[model samples]
Target: MYIFSGDFAFLEIWYVSSSIPNMLVNILSESKTITFSGCFLQFYFFFSLGTTECFFLSVMAYDRYLAICRPLHYPSIMTAKFCMILFCVCCVSGFLCYPVPIVLISQLPFCGPNIIDQIVCDPGTLLALACVPAPSTELICYTFNSMTIFGLFLSILGSYTLVLRAVLRVPSGTGRTKAFSTCTSHLMVVSLFYGSLMVMFVSPTSRNPAEMQKIVTLVYSAVPLLLNLFIYGLRNKDMKDALKKVLRL
Candidate 1:
């Protein structure tokens, strides 16, 4: 819950796929060919998975805050059933939200050049390939972008604010420090994931900023994926200890 889970998933898939362009741009610069189904899968998966990830992470953050700030009732407040419901809610809700945008995107017709500016599959880029008859394409893009950015931003902001308040309540130097150690990693991941996304898309795409935009693209999409596992997955002492114990067995 510290970071948005849906965007996190989008970022993960985005970065991994995005990195390929950096290494292979020479041979694949303008080769922007994607099957109709491939196009749907890219956007559908990114948006759907990203939404689930965002909501799920928020739930996790709340769970952590409960554990740390309200230890006495943390179990009752956030039980296995509660967590399972959250997971299911995120998955089902994320998937269901796709029908409208998918239908909108599907109605467009593709009949001209199909050069995607950056690598990977961009919903906007794919929509641009739609023939002029598809007047609703731009509306779909704007709608998707607006809904996602707004929903994600508000969700993240509220969750982090609660988390910050919880962190502030830890007394004693060691207690505060230990609380930070747990919170810091998730905070960093959250910042990196959302920060990159906002920076990449908020501004109008311009030819003059083409070079800068490309670099930003790499940062927003690639660096975070590589960093998340290192910072959150491996760096936590408990995770390290668990790995070591498992290895010893």
Candidate 2:
């Protein structure tokens, strides 16, 4: 759990950092303009980080399942070496999935009115700005996003489902309660993330209103990142005790 938490903490930092600084600048600047290269760079990093986050969340769920459901074998199965491999796999897979769609979108011709209705470089918004229709491009982007979002989400559900079964089998109510408590924080974070993520990216052609898109994007991209500190950190007994000590000091 600590290994996964360390990876998650690093991911959350980069995930939020990728776009928030630029977003803050956009808020303060008069022109509210970003260069073509800048926009795509932001888009790539932001989405890549997001994709990485999905994998991390899924892995964390699997880790919890192993710990709870297969406690006897967990130490052997989830060694430091195995954890490092999982970390590498998540990062590589996350960064690799988006390049094809991003490249496809970047190749599209944008003649004029180069304004994007989104706060960030969203694929749907970028596609909308293209000079000609790009139904194929749109389909490709939608397929990639859907596969990543839904695939990882289902994996999480599967892990938790198994974990739930194991918890139910615990004969003692206290044991069941303890097992449920271990998973509750992770489940909350997953809910906060995937709820808005699915709405926004599952079917990009839904063409939600610009304001609506911004709101949803903020919910998934920024809100969960902020809430995770509370969900994972403050919710931990050690962290809470440390906080109380600091407060008293």
Candidate 3:
């Protein structure tokens, strides 16, 4: 769990850092302008880190499932070497998946009026600015987004489903309660992250009002990350005790 938490912490930091600084500048600046390369680069890093996050969440779910459902074999199966391998796989897969669509969209002609209505360089918004219609490109982007968002979401659900079954089988109520508490924080984070993402990305249309998009993007990208430490860290007994000690001092 600590290994997974360390990876998650790093992911969230980069994930938030990728766009928040630029967003703060946009808020303060008069022109509210970003160069073409800057926009795409932001789009690339934002989505790539977001994709990596989805993978890490699923990996964490799997770790919990193994720990809870297969405790006897977990130490052997999830060895240090195996954890490193999983980390590499998640990072590499997440970074590799989105380049094709980004490249395809970058090649589209943007003759004039290249204004993106949203604060972030969303693929949908960028596609709308193309001088020529890009139905094929739109379809490709939608397909990729849908596969990543839904595919990993279902995997999380599957892992938790098995976990739920195992928890139910524990004869003692205290045991069941402890097991549920262990998973509750992770489930909260997952719900916040995936719920906002599905609303923003998995839909068939990009017709949401600009304000609505911004709010949803903030919810997924910023809100969950801001609350992660509280959800995961503050809930720990050791962390709570430490906080109380600091307060008393």
Taking the candidates one at a time, how many backbone clashes does each contain?
Answer: 10, 0, 0
Candidate 3: tens digits of C-alpha lDDT, residues 1-249: 878887888989998898899989989989888999999999998999999999989999999999999999999999878887998899899899889989999999998887877768989899889999999999998888999999999999999999999999999999999999989989999999999999888885466777888899889888887799889898778999999999999
Checking candidate 2 for backbone clashes, the offending pairs are none
In order, the Cα lDDT scores of the candidates are 0.63, 0.90, 0.90
Stretches of candidate 3 off by over 4 Å are: 245-249
lDDT value, residue 213 of candidate 1:
59
Model 1 segments more than 4 A misplaced? 1-32, 133-136, 202-222, 238-249
Top lDDT hit: 3
lDDT of 1: 0.63
Encode model 2's per-residue lDDT on 17-69: one tens digit a residue: 88888889889999889999999998999999999999989999999999999
lDDT of 3: 0.90
Better of 1 and 3 by lDDT: 3
Error of 1 at 163 (Å): 3.2
